[model samples]
Target: MSQKAIIEALKNPDAYDEKVFYVKVLQTHISYIFLTGRYAYKVKKPVNFGFLDFTTLEKRRFYCEEELRLNRRLCGDMYIDVLPITLSDGSVKINGSGKIVEYAVKMKELPQEALMSELLKKGRVDMNVMDEIARILSDFHKKAETNGKIESYGSIDTVRFNWDENFDQTREFIGRTIEHQDYSFIHRAVQEFLKNRKDLFRLRLRKGRIKECHGDLHSGNIFIADRIYIYDAIEFNERFRCCDVASDIAFLLMDLEFLNKSDLSNRFLIKYLEYSGEEEDFLEVLPFYKCYRAYVRGKVTSFKLNDPNITEEEKERSKEIARKYFQMSRQYAEEIF
Candidate 1:
């Protein structure tokens, strides 16, 4: 089906469920999301990034199912199921009795105000929420999958590859988004830390510190309802989602720091350590993961600058946000001192 057909189908709420209310459409670089008041349907775009491929109908459907299965680990009720979009007689409809053309992952929409990012903006995020999150994450990590194969991802080589990929991807945007000195300093710090702590990375693997974790844990992915719903686990690739739990939580830590909530960040980490029963010494290697996480945010925002759909003003804003993330990455690297 054409994009025009999809847009038209989106306009008609009847295409999805039995409802007449208007459906809201949200777009990201890789997906078109239709919000139908009570539910949201996410359709992956036919894009091929080297790391993830959803370029074919079959691949998109597989990933849709993978997303539903993986996300249901953390968000039990949020992820409903994957529904096939059918096209026939010059029209497209979701779950229609026709030939399947596309696939969508249906989900239960959470309240906008309950998003942790929005809560942080209003200074409404408190230690209580942090503590609750810490507990939830602790329980989650305990039950998270672990095996020899997944543990290998925590090796120094694998860890370094992740950092190397970040540096390589962002190198072209040096002067345009991040200062050369900031990039150089962070690169050197990360390399040195990884080199010096090969033993620590190995020890983490030996201790089963590596597992299938919530690869993306920024504040935006978390909803602070009665229960904390950490949705959107990386389903496109296991390499992205499998790692030391420290690195997983570090993403959230770096996000809080990016929002200028260092005190809460510290509180959250401390509570996490307490609940997870990880030693205080785990703090030593945290800067490494935190820096990596910050760089990832900068990298992602920098990529947004090149998107054709983004307005000039939005691109400029993204440039500034990316710069700030790079700056934060440098600070985290400095903490390694």
Candidate 2:
């Protein structure tokens, strides 16, 4: 079945074994997620944009499995397993006895109100919450896998490769969501940092600070329930996942700053450094990583304009958001470089 057909078929309650009253659907750039009452199933779309590729069924299955495995590192209880959506006698059913038409990452559904973002908006996230999140991440990073190959991703060349790819990808959206001046400045700042700080990158690599990490560590990916359940890691590309631990932690800190909660961001970073026993000079390289994270966020939001399904109002809103992220990137760059 095609993606459209699968989406349409999954809307009915019969598609799932659970007794669902109504099935809700949500989509991101790469996957369509169907939310049953008791569970959620995510199906990757057949799209490849160089950095991320889910163009084939086998590749999708592989990524689905990868998602399950990598996310289990922290939020083990939330991720159930990857299951095949089989087509049988002209009917599409999840995990049915027939030829497999698609793969989905099935997960135990948690309440929306439990998300850290929602809690943040409600003024429920305080310094204590930040400290707990810091401790969780610090512990995870300490135990995270790292080898010579993983440490190499922390090299200056790899850092340049990731930044260059972002610039190349976002060039088309210069006038739409990002200003030409902002793009040029960010490019120059990144290149200058790369050229001048080769030793800093090597210092990070030599510290054995590189490890497989949760690339997407924003508030949305976190659930402040009985425990801190961080989900939806960057599973498609090892380039994003395997990097300096500082780079991984910079994402959430940057996100807090985006929410105008720099106090919490500062507290979180301090707690993380304390818990992890990271070197004091770790602060020296953080602004660069924060700038990288923010600019990539802007580029990602700008890509939403390409989705035909998005309403005009949402596109306009995304444009505003993209601009803000780019501005944040510029601020981070100007602060040091």
Candidate 3:
């Protein structure tokens, strides 16, 4: 089924349950999510953005399965299953006995108020929650996959590749969203830091700090219910997800700082370091990773300006957001040598 048809079908509450109260459709750059009171169904768009390709039905199915399987590790209870959307007699049916046209990952609908991002807005994220989050991530990183081959991604070359890709992709927005001088200065600062800090990367690899950690560990992905539920791991690309533990943690820390919660960010980082048993010296190399995380965010936000589905108002908001993130990235770069 086309995205429109699939979304229309999901908008009907009876698609999931006859007694369901209502259905709400949410849109992202790459997916359409249907919130059916009790469950949320995420349908990936048939688009190829170079880094990820879900244009084919087979690829969508595979990624749906991958999303369900991978997210189950952290929030098994929330990730329900992947269901096929079938085209029948002039209508679409979810998990119906017809020709399968697309796939949707079903999940238990978590309360919006419990989301860490939302909680942060309400000023409800306290020390206890931060400590719990720190402990959960520490344990997760400890058990994450690490091998000789995956560890190689922690090398300076791979780091360079990631940054180069970022710089190349965002080059067009240099003068519009990002200042030319700031871009060039941060670019050089990052290159010099990576070139000069090979020993830090090497030390991380030797100590097994590189692993298959969550690539997107921002506040939005975290839910503070009975326990912390960190879902939506990046299943499309391993290069984005697999990295130094500090880099993974840096994303969340950067997100907190972006939200202007430096007190919480500092508390979370200190507690995380104490729990992970990492040396305090690890702080020295964190700003570099934070800059990378912030730059990636700006790149993503700028990409939304090109999305046709969003309104003009949204584009204006995204423009401001992209500038804010780019400035934050530059701030982190300034902290480096």
Overall lDDT per candidate, in order of appearance: 0.86, 0.89, 0.88
**lDDT digits (tens) for residues 23-53 of candidate 3:** 8888878889887778888999887767689
Predictions ranked by TM-score, top down? 2, 3, 1
TM-score of 3: 0.97
Task: Kindly list the per-residue Cα lDDT of model 2 for residues 1-337, writing each as its tens digit.
Answer: 6778988999888988668856889888788888887888999988888999999999999999999999999988889999999899999999888999999999988777999989988988889988998999999999999998988888888899999999999999988878899899989988888888888888888888999999988998998888779899999999999988888888898999999888999999989989999985578899998998999899888988888767899899999999999999998988657
Q: Model 2: residues >4 Å from true position, as ranges?
A: none
Report the Cα lDDT for residue 52, model 3. 81
Error of 1 at 228 (Å): 1.7
Question: Which of the two, 1 or 2, has more TM-score?
Answer: 2
TM-score of 2: 0.98
Candidate 1 stretches with Cα past 4 Å from truth are none
The TM-scores of all predictions, comma-separated, are 0.96, 0.98, 0.97
**Candidate 1 per-residue lDDT over residues 1-337, each given as its tens digit:** 6654776677786687556355888777678888777888898878775667888889999999999888999998999989988877866888787899888899988777899999999999999999999998999999999998898888888888888888888998999889999999999999888878778887788788899998999899999887889998888878889998999889999999889899999999989999999975477778888888999889888987778767899899999999999999999999885
Ranking by lDDT: 2, 3, 1
